[model samples]
Target: MASCILMQFPGTSDPTVTVIATGGTIASTADAQGARVPTLDGAALIAHSGTPIPTRVIDSTSLDSSSMRLADIDELAGHIQEAFADPTTSGVVVTHGTDSMAETALALDVMLDDERPVVLTGAQLPADDPHADGPENLAGAIALAALPAQQPGVQIHFGGMTLPARGALKRHTYEMQAFTSSATTPLSRPRPVGVHRLAGKNVVVIAAWPGAGRAEVDAIVATRPDGIVVAGLGAGNISADMGRALGECLQAGIPVVVSTQVPFGPVAFDYGGAGGGNTLGSLGALSAGYLSPGQARMALTVALASGTDPAVLLA
Candidate 1:
């Protein structure tokens, strides 16, 4: 079990922002092999943030964001829930890896039903770097988390912008301004579903290509996943053979979600034919709307684990 450390700043009477640190580049230091690894904990990150906000730091997992699993997300959500249980805790700040931060933000956005803010932030450069952006990003997240009049739900605070989690995507690999969101409004707040572990629920994402076919879909279906999300081509259209294979999965009681490979815009039912979004919808596959494939996968995993209908939640 992870331990919590209460860091009392100058203002004891101020509402507290609980900082939960799950290691990412913000807390990482380069190893002997010149590869960065997570080495700093929540307390260290808060210190680096240089913020005066009263806070309670919890040292969660130390891991690269790419190494995170569904179970890890479940654990992180549990920590956020625990932090919100305290009446003095006004909001929460999560220091996460940029690689998978958007997915975690989406999970928390849908899972928690709190009015208080939940801000996720991380750095693109290692903590030890002279021009590291972790401190500034962490400072912004803390400020957002500490805002008394902030809108509810989860958001990513990075590169000076606070983006809603629903359609958030990491657009740049190593840039300070890494995330972008096309969603204009907050997601409908879901009733708190307590803690749901997605360990056993298997959901996979398959990218559609120019000539993707049944063999590609067959290989994934052979794994017998609980659900499948197709990152289809423009307007969520797959090749005829790929669409047929996905249709079969739907017939077998597997949920299929159609998302677009394009960075912006929603998946539209603008085309018809074997591989069209309209055809996939007719075959019982749900459209992911504006969701990126990664966000769709997280939403699908949570929905399946919580016994929520993917059609109602995802489509």
Candidate 2:
């Protein structure tokens, strides 16, 4: 699954752009279930972009977002690093599936340290749809990546809207414009030090439910995952029972992260209890800040593999 293919699209002797494809809706065709599946590759997506420039295409993987794993992300980042090293390269555009685009974008945002645009774009409709948005989004991504004055950072560009990868989220399922950010303050997740390969990192996400017992957390701890991201209740609160379980995980040397299940806001210690943010803090559980549970999972997965103390990294 760690294979990459260099593609030959119509090129220009002028500024060069690199279009990297991973499997996503932009590359998908319809399946019998009527769901748009990830069946297309980078070559197909680049052709849809209308020959933007002298472009280099790399197909990192074709797995749908749900099928995406840590290894695939590591490989993708490696290719981006190599491509961006070329001085003539203006920027890099990524074609991905929207289902897990946020996690991938967030992963790239922290792991890469380059001065070129890394635009990840995906489509709500599949390539076979008459009303697909992949081409336009891809073209826009190229435009942004090729911008001489565009500031460098990982970003998600979709449906005429652009935002930083740290704060981007898939807010809607079927809507064409699925990703969004805070209306007031644009935020970024914890700065990623460098790319970390999650080959042996064990991580899991456990959501808190009303009256839920600590058994869920105990079960996770029993397996001894490297890290855990618990999507807590309102504003990062969890059940008292689960809070104790998290404490146990920390005691066992496993890093536990607390994040909000909601789309916005940071996890703070403004309250107190066995499951309160303050209690979790006292138990050595770290905060995910404004990152959603999914993003927190990615951050923890990478940071653990990189040997960065979760407390310092999440702090």
Query: Which candidate has the top score in lDDT?
Result: 1
Give the alpha-carbon lDDT of every model.
Answer: 0.87, 0.80
* Model 1 alpha-carbon miss at residue 173, Å: 1.2
Clashing pairs in 1: none
For residues 204-279, write the lDDT of model 2, one tens digit per residue. Answer: 9999987778988888877878889999887788888888888888888888899887886678776688888898
How do the residues 1-315 of candidate 1 rate in per-residue lDDT, one tens digit apiece?
A: 677998875565668999998999999999999999999999988888899888999888999999989888878888888988887888899999999999888888777888888999999999999999999999989988887636656889999998888889999998789999755665554554446887888899999998777897899889989999999999899988899899999999999999988988889877888888999899889988888999999888888888887655554
Give the range of the ten consecutive residues with the poorest summed lDDT in model 2.
4-13
TM-score of 2: 0.92
- What TM-score do all the candidates reach, one by one? 0.95, 0.92
What number of clashing residue pairs does each candidate have, in the order they appear? 0, 1
